[model samples]
Target: MLPIKLENIKLNQQYKNREDYFKKMGEQLFSAGLVNEGYSTSIINREEIYPTGLATGEINIAIPHTDYQFSRTTDIFITVLKTPIAFFRMDEPEKTVEVSIIVQILFDNPEKQPDILKELMEIITNQRVLKEMIAAQEPKEVLQHFQINN
Candidate 1:
């Protein structure tokens, strides 16, 4: 793991659409000098191809990511939307989603693979965890509630 913490991750208010969200996230990471120039575009492109939207039936989530080379350090950004954002489902490509949260992950190593997604999936899949996360108004509260053991 890198020296970066969840504190480094931010919930951007600038995102209106998926494109805007990613652009803003990339801009934040790039301007912070945490990633390269093409980082954001790469991740967003990969998201379009693979599609990370998850539908829990209660609260949907979008986990967008790329090939793990976009970051100078391994990190993740968690953004809670006051209003749900539309995304495409991973399993059903033709389906659309209304996601309440967006988690933008940057993996520095590809070997991490399913672990990261697995953890995220576990969190999002659990109604209890989802409720806690959604109820959290501040980023610090969010960081406090979610813990990554790996």
Candidate 2:
């Protein structure tokens, strides 16, 4: 099972940009003992170099992450925004995608990132699941949806 706590799932959050969102979420992860102190900075730097945005047909999503060295454990933090934010697409950095969901990955083992990311992409691209997740009223609902589906 994924190390996704209900507390890690934020609903209807407001952030000015990717950096602000990452910093806030990173602080939560740090408090929960999921990430190291500098994890947020590393994530910001990494995102600048390699954007993790994806424009799926259902909804745009961003998977912000950094090296495993910055993580204390393996966990996934989800933040559903009140309004979509612009993020550079991973495949086409020149293009920007309006991201409604942010999936922050913190893993202690680098070897598992590829498989985890693949599964996350599959979940994000599923229209039905994505719609359900977006419409979920509470953090527990979001976690339940993921637990049942993934």
Give the alpha carbon lDDT tens digit for every residue of 5-70 in model 2: 897898888999887888878787788777888988899899989999998866789988899999
Off by over 4 Å in 1: 1-4, 8-14, 148-150
Name the lDDT value of residue 19 in candidate 2: 78
TM-score of each: 0.86, 0.92
Residue 141, candidate 1: C-alpha displacement in angstroms: 2.2
Model 2, clash count? 0
In order, what lDDT does every prediction score? Answer: 0.74, 0.85
TM-score of candidate 1 to 2 decimals: 0.86
When summed lDDT is taken over every stretch of 10 residues in candidate 1, the lowest stretch is: 1-10
Best by lDDT: 2
